[model samples]
Target: MPIYIYWGEDDYAIERAVVTLRDRILDPLWTSFNYTSFPPEQSDAAIAALNQVMTPAFGAGGRLVWLMNTTLCQNCPENVLAELGRTLQVIPENSFLLLTSRNKPDERLKSTKLFKQLATEFREFPLIPPWKTELLVQAVNQAAQTVGVRLTPQSAAVLAEAVGNDTRLLYNEIEKLRLYAIEQNRPIEVDTITRLVRNTNQNSLQLAAAIRVGDTGKALTILADLINAAEPELRIVATLVGQFRTWLWVKLMVESGERNPGAIAQAAEVANPKRIYFLQQEVQSISLRQLISCLPLLLELEVSLKQGRAELSILQTKVIELCQVCRRN
Candidate 1:
């Protein structure tokens, strides 16, 4: 397996994987000669990488060529595709070619299809959306294991809730907790995580929750705290939009007399069918009309922020309006 495809929005995880691959494939003594990297700035980087990977290592270790942040899987020129087809067929067993991108490989593209056929591995490190608590918990557990630390299930959940979908933060927190555990000489518990992690109780998801129940004051407070913490305004809007959009879909499905959890989850674009039960309960008090109305206000907020309006004022006003929409009789 000499060819690898790594793609996803979780760039930190992808880079970490690349580092591990580099260590495994390149001999430390000959690393300077065996490793070649192509940043996206270089024109025809894919072709250059493919050409480089064809050459055998200069010394004892295998050759490793990395095409960083490549767009070949998204859109490849016919010439590059032709070159890729040729190189992949004869890439030496001891030489490795790695292509990484933040976007998923477009399955419809010929380049992606070719890579799928020839690449030894296709690994994705997608960022779990903040609303997916189960997946986030699993991520926390996985990172803890990799860091050689033990975490109680309750502590893992707490850590997941604190870090959300930020892979880098999750790993950093786990490492910190590992250190604390070593000092205390005990497995990580909820109290240690609570003491070590910053802003554990506040997040944009909480803002969405506050808005969902029509608690204007609480929503405004959470928004202020997030802003104070230097959270990106656009990112906050993105999370709110995704949360409301999911709620709207679930409510629409349930109102239409759809009972199957799998069907509802599919329609709502939720990864886990088990989450449908919780989503159903969330929107039970709020009307579908309310959910429908929240999206436009949220969009307006996004546009206002992007247009360079006063962030604090615009956010407060739109959040109030969203709360009002949900509060309607």
Candidate 2:
């Protein structure tokens, strides 16, 4: 019951715990350690290894056992999970057991006898993203500082947008930015951030980018893929409308004495700060008339789709036609 669990998709939180355990508790004191990563598909050997690792010996300083990326409760065979629970009951206090997972365990398990006892004896922390601007900015700053790279306010916003709430991807992208900065011997810039990080929202951003750039061919390709994936036209239209609004805000903000993309993004409340620069540039080419006119068309199409005035085939044709009209305007 001494197994502490730390769960999140946030890589930095998981990494910090891993490093702390390794450095302060395990490595410094010279405890023998075993780290096992159990993906959803590979539970058998991982569970068996955990059983073997936690079996204590009199002379051993203690074992440090780490189970990573496990989804045992959700996907494992019932017999296997039951065996795992039974195994958890016997883990030696002298041995430190750690579980790192992207998903939380079931609520039933959380209230069950074994988990209740484990909770009493062990610490549990969830490192979900804060989903607020301030915390996201702090995360970006902390990650950049780790590598001695300094971000201009604009650069930080770009990095934030490109990484977008995926802490693991943010760290990886920051590391890549660090490498790029070192290789080029330059301060980190927005373009460098854009070049390195591929955010989870990249496709949506790409669609926006293509539309902004008047790349009808690219826009059509992106539209076709979304249509094939069965994404609702109304939803797609709504997203684009929102993106374009953000772009317009950035454009307006920049022209009105707010030259920094980050500042504009913060003021506009755009979720992806990193996109502000591209958006600003993109918005410059779009006339106010086009922005005003296209939105109504998207809205009309949305209503039409909702009313079943057209099937997906017709809806897709309308989308392409909208793209052409927007680009031409």
Candidate 3:
């Protein structure tokens, strides 16, 4: 049989799909499961590994062969593609081959004889971002429910706020929350939600807080920590920009006489009410026109860094400089 493929846009659904596949395929059919994952750059080695896995166990019932975490389709070299196409053509029926990726296969490969044959013989499931908030909530709830933990509406809403659209991080937080609940023997109440679900790495939050407070020294300190953690400079920039935007919005909401921080934070999905203070300050410090103008400059900086017009470290420096300037104005 040809290889079955499953892919996802982000880590959570991708991981769930892998877990589901493993549960469904293993244990029932065979004694031994042979699984391997390949990096994108190791095309030749990946092809070799696949061959080894698909080579029958000889007189045994069969084996499950898996290639996980590959980016072959996204960045495969021309010569490697030709070799892969040949290798894929002859996978035997006794072995089950599965390939999971975060990337879609190349269009050229999709049209090739090998991919066509594989597509005809095996199933392909692509994991997409949840189209609705209910879907996203259900996924988190299901994961929690499996662990005998339940989320209150407010807690679930808080979790959603912290996660935004990053289900991978959401799932990770859920796992942590589940473990914490089991250990502590407490229901996930609103106060518990405030402490746990809204939590983030102190550095990321500190950086955001510093930007909100117009504290260049604090922002730079947090930025350094993020960089040392190997966060991409571009990601840091994007995150800072996002926080600034939120601060501007919250400030506007407050100035318009919205006294309830919870209501304002709820609208923006900020789980922590205390965050309102910093957010309100950011709005007060700058005008709406200034915030609007700063966004494009930040975008240009991102483009320059990614396109090699600027070094990553230099880009971070520029980001700090720009934010400091904004604070002054």
Candidate 4:
């Protein structure tokens, strides 16, 4: 149980997990001697890490060999795979091998299958998509608990809305709240969270909501707020695209008489089927045609942003056009 595979888009979460694992495996005094990290930029890092992990700890602690941002599971060379197979079979009990990646390991790959057979732990830390409100709220609560801060349910929801899927920000905010709660000697509430957390009121998801309702003025205002807050233009467009795409799929499924939430959730690639109910309600007013139309416009907006067009004005124009599309009968 020495091999670990951690992969996903949530880099912050993965790093945090790595820190925890490192702390558990290596003594603080002997860390420098026993801990070895192979960054992805290093040539032959995977092989190097394998070789390093096979070596015993220098002193009083177990050894930890980390292959950070590795792609071995996705595309391991024949030599590397053979080495990995040999290493895993005889890897020392006191030595740990950790492989981390941003991409999901292709399960079809032989390397992935080999890892699955011998991996002590395999965990994915996927970012909660902005549109998945429930998961975000759950993430907020879990982070708060980990940071030793107690949050009212309402406060958790508010914080989730504020941070969206930014795990780093969420953890920082929770730590801040924990410190404030200690000083104030009170439980964290919605009001406290609202006042303390920056950008609590505006986010890309709010922009998507405004566009969903065809509120041109509201969408523009949110767009301005997001821009003023220095949210990336491309990120804003990505959120919109994801939101609209989800709505389109849900709408298409519902209109075609598909009532099973699980089926619809699968089609939309949503994690929780229960959220499909809320999504169904959101898309009830808009036609599938309108949802379908928004994608091309969003694509154009993304293209314009990538093409080095003025961000605010370009975003403003696209938001207005999107609102207009949703408004059409």
Clash count in backbone of candidate 3? 0
Q: Per-residue CA lDDT of candidate 1, range 1-329, in tens?
A: 58999999898999899999999999999999999999999997888888899898998989999999999999999999899877898999999999899988899999999999988999998888787788889999899989988989998988898888888888888888777777565678888888899753478899999999999999988898888877778878888999999999999999999999999999999988999999999999999999998998998999899999999999999999999999999
Q: Write the per-residue lDDT of candidate 2 for residues 1-329, one digit (tens) a residue.
A: 45666665555667777777655434433553333334446547556656755776345355566666665433566576677667776777766666667776665653233554664233344442322344567778987898678898888877775654566677777877777777565578777676766643444446656766667778767777666655446656656666666655666676678877668878877666776765666777776656656667667767787888865666556556656656774
Cα lDDT, all candidates: 0.90, 0.63, 0.62, 0.90
TM values, all candidates = 0.88, 0.51, 0.60, 0.85
| Clash list (residue pairs), candidate 4 | none
After superposition, candidate 2 runs with Cα above 4 Å error: 6-20, 23-25, 28-50, 57-62, 75-90, 102-104, 109-136, 165-169, 176-203, 206-329
Q: Would you give me the overall lDDT of model 1? A: 0.90
Q: Which one wins by lDDT: 1 or 3? A: 1
Report the C-alpha lDDT of model 4 over 34-80, residue by residue, as the tens digit: 99999999988988998899999978879999999999978889999
Q: Report the candidate with higher TM-score, 3 versus 4.
A: 4
Model 4 segments beyond 4 Å from truth? 183-186, 227-235, 246-285, 299-316
**Error in Å for residue 111 of model 4:** 1.9
lDDT of 4 at 151: 85
Best by TM-score: 1
